[model samples]
Target: MPVQRIFFGWPVPAMPPRRIAVLLGSIALFAVITLVFTLPNSIPSGPSLGRFTDHKISLPKLPKTFSSPSILSPFRVAAHPPPVLKNTTSGDSKWYSNWNWLSPFSSSVTLDENRSLLPPLNERPPIYTYYDHTQKKAADLKAADNALLLTWRRAWWAQGFQPIILSPAEALNNPLYAELQTLELDSTLKVELSRWLAWENMGTGILCNYLVFPMGAQEDHLLSFLRRGKYPKLTRFENLGHGIFVGSKAEITAAVKTALDNPELKTAKDFISTVPKETFQVDPHHESVAYYDPVVVKNKYPKIDEAISKGANGLEILNKLIISHLHGTWRNRFSKGIAVLKPEPDHMSAAIEPAFTLAEFLAQCPESPMPSSCPPNRPKCSPCMASTPLKISTPPTYRNTSELYTIGTVPHPFTMAVLSSFRDNIDVPWIRRESSRDPWITALTKEVSGTGVSSAPRIIKFKEAVASEHGTFHTLWLTAEKEVPQDLDWRFGFTIPRNATDTGKSETPVPGPERRPQPKPDPKNGPVANPDDVKKERELLKRAKDFGQARTPAEEKLRGAIEAWNLADTEAWRFARAFLARSRVERLKWEEEEKHYVGGAGAERGKSSGWGRWFDD
Candidate 1:
């Protein structure tokens, strides 16, 4: 019988030790197998690929103005009230209401009405003007109304200025505005304190000469005339006329501060006297009507020298002769002046209407499928319009004058549009063409866009002023030379000095700042490497490594673009040189072939006529 173990109370058999050992061995084998499979996954591999890899890299914080971040900056942006569509009394809609459906992008949308669709980087500069509803004088009110209307028409519609019309109340919201309300002003004068405060708050260096439009008088030629001259501090009339004041954002803000701080100044001339003498230059073509004209004199005007003043800041003197004969002379040129007088009519309507439909504007845009290469045809884009209007269609006239070759518009409009819609602070490259100038050094004293040149300090100041309005200055380069200058302060923006082959090495140093002091020879180590030289080498190696070993998909794509841009720039010159070389070689080969054929023909003729063989021999 088999040995049996009693379950609860009986005797047990003791012959199973070998079987128990086998079972235990089997359990151990299974545990070992599980550990082999699971331990590799559970344990951290290495710092480069394990826990460290899981941590996301933190990019450096971008500048406040860099890449137009939509961070609601403390700096003020000029605002425009939405245009009223319906006429309260007539019950008829304005002309643009019907035009909403005629939009180029989509049938239901108007481009300007939806600011979301406008190009993100390079926006048109705002031209600030204002009117006071509480004015007691008819002439002052009418003058303000008329000046604002014509100014809007020419500045917005004709010249592409973004017009901003602020109210007296809007300006008074600033504590500084109330300080200005006490100064004396002429009955015909409309003080531009509102405009000054708005401009000061705008925190940009964009041209603010259009402020003159609302103050003295509006002229059809005034805006265009101002554009032709260097930014003038004051528009001089023949007889110390202080009717019109014009200047840059700096000049205007300074003058406004002077006027506000000085309460003793009475007349426009006194206020003008406080401004710097550098601003007091003669400009006969300034052409605004005389401040002491008969119409102005009849409106309770005082003698040129009075001691008491009453408006907000002495800025009331800014437009002592707000309306001139030009207002009546050119009144019908823009519009009937009826829409302007209406309290509800939209000032911005004329800007986006009849001159060119929003559809036409969109069609000519660089993002369009087939946009015109002409700068004038395309809507004003800062990056594309950096150079003068003349230089866009052709290369610069002078040799080595340097030209910024724009890569036209990138074709991925949908991606750009989406990104812009989200207001992402990403650096979207505006230009990717080979520059004859290195941009880094040129931007120090001259505009890379070829606007003009100035002292390095002044240029830097201007850049700082405008950087908030425009984005931070940056450039992408595929150098025509072997290396980028090591001396330029690369701290300004991103710089990737790459070659066509991507060899990640640079030989010849491009022209740059003076060499820094070289390291002294060491007794033991021979010589220490120059910091700049080492830095440059490290940069090249680092950039190459980063480019090749892009850890993520986004980085990989960005590197790909870098590669493409460099290749495109280099290939442009390479192909051009290759074409020229091949053409010359082909031409020589053709000439030789022709000579041989002629000789053979002559020999045949000699064989026939008996003189060809003698000539050949």
Candidate 2:
């Protein structure tokens, strides 16, 4: 009755209960089949209840024939000691211990039995001495003076001139003598006399010698010579006490004319005019050479006209004039202060006679002609005839052989003399005798060799016997040609070994401080294992595990190799974890893409399906 009366909603249908049950059963069957085919076999249904438990209980049984080491035996139970190790053996004690043979002894020993076998330690040093040649003839003068005076007289006579000697005291007191002195005759005396005698005349010629007359007497002699109108050759034109000589009146007059004619000479004449007549009279009779008074001359003639006229250009002229005046003034002052201690005639004669004769003969002879005294058979004088004349195109240039000899040898001569003087004074016996193997000489030899000087002299080698006797060792000497620069002060230092004796053996070892111990290396910071070793270890472990047993050395090495393999595995696991982590991140991105694509496809399918339904209707 209810079915006849019932009204259903749109799209609903009524069915029997049996038909509904069959439909539900068919749906359940379909779902079971789909799940069976789609699910993965690897996925476990639940927790592994007893799978690993069974494996743990079923250990492989040993065969009856196998004989394992007893568990209680020391061999089976023994374990490698902890990795920490101790170095008890002396061989492994310290790195330096390996060289213990070189260690220093605790105490020095004196073995009397082998005293002769060992070399001696104490030795003597080398010595050097020097000598001077310039002062060799200083002890004799009278003979020189006499010879000089005679030569002067003869030269004057040959030139038709006469010389007059005067007392300075008389000259100063007498107006006539004073007038004569006022003419600068005394100042220009040497030059005037030399010129009058035509003695290789040159401008402002200079003559040098040791002094023998008082300054005042020299002045008086010069004045008298000037008044005589005749020239005389100078005995000894040397620095001594007061004034220089004119030697003749003709020389004086000629000098005056020369000064008056040349403005430059006028200055010099004016300077000479200022000298006090009385100043030239002091120690009037004293037999000693004297110096000129530059102060008096400057006071009398304060102008530099002579300097200007002489073409004294730049600093050179100024220096020359100043030096000349300073020297003259110094000599005059020195003479005034000197005590009038008369020298013996014999002493003077001994020092000067021979030199004076040689000088006079050399001066008078025309430098070109050979002397008759020369060997008769020779075509030219062997010693007198020089290979070439001395020439100096430049101011500082030197050409005379004698001058060169003097320049090269003079300084060293004095130094040598000083050194020689010290010989007896020094206490060391080694210092008295010159040693050929001296360090200074050796150094000098090395230095000369390095200089590449083509003509440098070779150093003399010492005799072995002499060196052995003196215990002298070869050394280097550094001798410089000129003063060293302040900036290069290091060059002044000479290298000297601590031990100077040769000892006929190798050099002694230099002592040094004790060495410190080196620290041991840290394992963590030790050198990394070789990559090939790591790879080989890995391959060995893999082969052992694959075979299920160790067979060879390579396979047996896998006992501890698993730990190394674990390290590599850890590295690979880290890489896999990173890859998986990155994949999860990409999965999220893919899910988002799927959502978008699915949403779009769903919308399109709905529209298409609806249109098809519409067309079918």
Candidate 3:
């Protein structure tokens, strides 16, 4: 045996020097391979494909009065309550319960078998009235009811109210919004009839008049009788908006000053432009005077006048003194002196006339689809006598005035306990029509949906308001130019109503603010760049952005190494030498590191590098 030694389980026979060198090299290579597999050192995920390319990337504000967020926002989204089903009890009211469209009269749903569904938004409940599929009449609403709802939604419109305009007129350099509605209400609730009455001692053709209905025991009896399929109204009295007007002493004084200063002012638009939007709800910074604060002013105004008043804000004094303006004295200023700009005759014929008779509608019965089953053939019954009686339809007004008028059920804060105790008995459901908008007017006018301008409007010109006995030939209404002004602030509900679209086909309505049109880009901000440049810039930006978001030093190093390796074929020598040097170093380290596996952890501390490993202690 030529110089043999047993260093491990097998006998290591000393070979020739060349063979020994080869065996040593092979051992070192195996250790390097083992270290590559066994060591914790890692080169991330993408670049280590033996080198090449690796790159990649990756308010809780509710609108309006719904200001607060839900408690469950941190976890799962809170389940929205289900919509009211027909004939269901009131307890199951859901988020969309207020969305009473497509449901049977929700008013039929009773609270504790006594109350009606016609309560405040907070107190209203699910509808219990079922419309049987077989009942064709139930399936189809009386055209009059549709017309009434249509009209009711527009009840507050008048030339004197704040004018909400969609487009500018060619006549004058018209402001987009006409100061139309009187922000300073000049009428009191105590008056049953209007102070602006157009009649000779009779409240006929009143502008900006309240549509009062019988309240208290009278309202209950009528509503109860209505539930039993009876008359629409027991009394001739009807519900209305506050027969409101737009003047106060300050308003009148400023307007007189503006008028006196500018003799050329002829049109309402000119007068309106001069009135400040700060006087009303149009100012976003504050709300309309709180409903109750007016009372406190009445009791305390006298006491303040009793003393030499300090620098008490005059604005508050005017706000308080403004209360007296609600009397008849204030209304005379508008009705007698001012000439109003009004729409041409409103299409009230449909609302004023009954579309069908009781027997006529009932004739839609499967047994009788013939004309004989309709009106004329059947004995005429009063429109008010039918189940879907000619309910109080709203009189025609302008496209909802710019004023902060809501066309909901009347006398919200009931003055009498009778009106307040309405929930004590079963009454009709809250009408789906709150006068927010009229779908019929929408359909009839063929208004371009998003644009406020009517595409096929019947009336083109606005006529001046005429006195009651003046044998009026025309009615004044708002007119608009085809082009909507770009800079003008449009009013009305900024929040798109989450109701079903007029297109009847969509089942699920989206919930959120309606999307506004993209504003035209300003050239001053930045000129439009070439697409190719944009794309190149974007790519460069992506590279730069990576440094901030995700790229690590190790990753950058690995990426650089990969790029170098991939480009090595053309300029190979430097990279080849560098890689070989690193490989050799790694190989030498692993050779001694492998001894730790064979001889255990203690041996690692004792191992050496280069030729020193041959003398490990």
Candidate whose TM-score is highest: 1
Model 1 segments more than 4 A misplaced: 1-122, 136-156, 181-243, 261-263, 266-270, 279-617
Task: Estimate, for each residue in 1-617, the C-alpha lDDT of model 3 and write its tens digit.
Answer: 45567877789756788988998999999999989897755655554543454753322556655543454346646454334444222221121223332112222232221112221212111101011112233212323222222121121111111111111111112221122122222233101111211111211111122111111111134222322322221111111122122333334334334433343333223223334444322212111111112233234344433321432333233322222121111111222111121111121111111111111221111111121211111123121111221122122232223111111111011101111122212112221222122222332223223337542222111100111111111111111101111111011101111121132233334563245333343332122333454444334433333432454676455434332322211111121122223223333343354333212211213222232221234
TM-score of each: 0.25, 0.14, 0.15
Candidate number that wins on TM-score, 1 or 3: 1
lDDT of 2 by residue, 1-617 (tens): 33533456544467788999999999999999888987777568897667667454557887654655654356766444222212211211111111121111101122111111111212111110011112224222323322333222222221212212211322234323333434444455423322222321211222222111112211235423432433343222222322334333334345434433444443443323333332222223323222323442234323433433444232233222322222222222222121111011111121122222222222121221112222111123223222221211111111112121111100111112122232212222332353212222222223324434321132212111011211111111111111211111011011101111222344335552224333343332222333354454334333323333324564334322432222222222122222223223333343344334212211112122121221121
Please report, as a residue range, the 10-residue window in candidate 1 with the lowest summed lDDT: 336-345
After aligning candidate 2 to the native by TM-score, how far in Å is the CA of 450 from where it should be? 25
Q: Give the TM-score of candidate 1.
A: 0.25
C-alpha lDDT (0 to 100) for residue 615 of candidate 1: 18
Model 3 TM-score relative to the real fold: 0.15
Tell me, what's the RMSD of every candidate?
Answer: 29.1, 48.4, 38.1
Candidate 3 Cα misplacement greater than 4 A, ranges? 1-350, 353-617
Give the C-alpha lDDT of model 2.
Answer: 0.26
Per-prediction backbone clash count: 12, 43, 21
Each prediction's whole-model lDDT (CA): 0.33, 0.26, 0.24
